[model samples]
Target: MRRIAFLLLLAVGASALALSPQEGWDLVAAVESGNQEAYARLVEAYQAGDPEAGAALGVLYLNGVAYPRDLERARRYFEWAQAKGSGWGSWGLAILYANGIGVAQDDQKGFRYARESMERGYPGGKALYAMFLIGGGAGLKQDINEGVKLIQEAAATGDPVALNVAARYLASSDLPGLSRDPKKAREYWERAAARGYFLARGFLAYDFFFGIGGPPDQKRALELARPLVGFEPAATAVWATALYFGQGGLVQNRPEACRLAKDQAKLQAGVATIYGLCILEGVAPGERALGLAYLALAAAWKHPPAQSLLSDWQKRLTPEEVNRAKELLKNLP
Candidate 1:
């Protein structure tokens, strides 16, 4: 059987086996960045029955990095790798089942796979399972305390995903006994960013941009944010804000900021507000109507500032302009 062949080949693939989990992931990232040599080596490893390489291949297919996105192929590679006892394989399956990536969403299956991955000492799996416990999304009892405990346990290992989750929990104020602690969140995010977690970098960049939990470091903020502009929405928001305000050594580019926000903002409330503000203040009289339209979307997203701005804009603009805004809103996606 294929599984038997994998087990047998594992002995011959000591090179791949020697890599730590983080190093395996670093190789995947290299391939994702168009390193053909890395990709060739990974493929060679997989052909030689390296479970970690197989899992990395799954990641490539899952995210369309080196290969076109093919969820079914990803699943197949994951299954093969998991059969060989690769934690990354189980983690991939967990994400697929948890979010309905290629098949019907099955929270129970996701939870089971996440547990398997965690048992294998994968920090992402531990953090993921912790989320399922916290949200009770897997048809099980909710255990916020247990979930928080799990996050802390995983974070102690210094994995970026686990650290990011810990930061999120620290930042959340509505969870029963857990008070908001921006300082702790900032510290965790900084650690996660150092480990190359782009989302965490984005958050820390935002914090630096605005002096949250620390003094503003505009230079550092731009350094952390510019590379992530097209990759993470959080970074997009940071870049948009920075460019609009001419902060972080960036040239003031109100028009470019709004342009950057146009498509990316529809789903990001904060970015929508920035786009709306830019349009309102910088655009022509007629185009200003669309600014209110964008602000209205942000208001619908439950952004308090957006709602306040909407009220002010409605009061300041003429009735005709308000009607135009309404028309613009209807046409926006």
Candidate 2:
């Protein structure tokens, strides 16, 4: 959902200082010291079209250095730099749009901007934009195949998240289109886990415990899960499920499982609010809560459970009600 890194560079010739490489470093020091006059001078240099000055101005605006926070201005400066064909500008603008920081959220805009940066050889932007494409289904149709390819492109450029996802697909036979290859999957997942993608580690635990992709190794599974339990509620739930079932490498630990499940359930309940709201909107076709049909199709696209529930409800609804739902879903994203 966001870009991963920042670069620090400044202009020397435009600053009207002794033109040396260290001049850029000196301007950066001035910014860090909250010297407004020096900061303004640097900004003026940027206005004169020095790429270094532009980059420095972008940093100042982005960090609120020696000035009030102004993400809108930062976004503008980034746009200027990007127009000059700098990767940083494109990367910065993509993040701003993706997270709705300096502009309205526009997933497609963010996706295209990020892709542009990546195409310009920005590795971090490549991974981040690909993530937006995968999660937001922006620009591209919601094709899991294309999403996987974008993710692979990011992984090729060394994005840990891409690696984590690829590893998960290899390990799990659950991914939509990838062939099931246990050994290859194990290799990818294990490599990602070593690099600290804790989710991949947790998935590795599942694989070892279930022996779907490899020989059962409960102890190794627990070893992997231990580091991941606190990272995500879902991960915690998996660990608890393992303990509850006493099937994974862990010895039966029901008390621990019960405690963890209770905690995890609370988090899940909060997420269920989305589903509940969709039902309230009458998008679930047979939503018992709201009789009005506003957007049944949205509910179906959001989840398989909603689709199944809507199908069941449609069987009992009158023809008029069913037709209304069909219309609503057709208009939904």
Candidate 2: worst-modelled 10 consecutive residues by lDDT: 1-10
Clashes of each: 0, 4
Which number leads on TM-score?
Answer: 1
- Tens-digit per-residue lDDT, 164-191, candidate 2: 6566455434545455677767766676
In model 1, state the lDDT of residue 148.
Answer: 78
- Candidate 1 on 260-308: residue-level lDDT in tens? 7776777566688888887788742327788888889889875556888
Candidate lDDT values, in order = 0.78, 0.56
Q: Give the poorly placed runs of model 2, Cα more than 4 Å off.
A: 1-128, 131-146, 157-159, 171-177, 246-251, 263-333
TM-score of each: 0.68, 0.42
For candidate 2, give the lDDT of residue 258.
52
lDDT of 1: 0.78
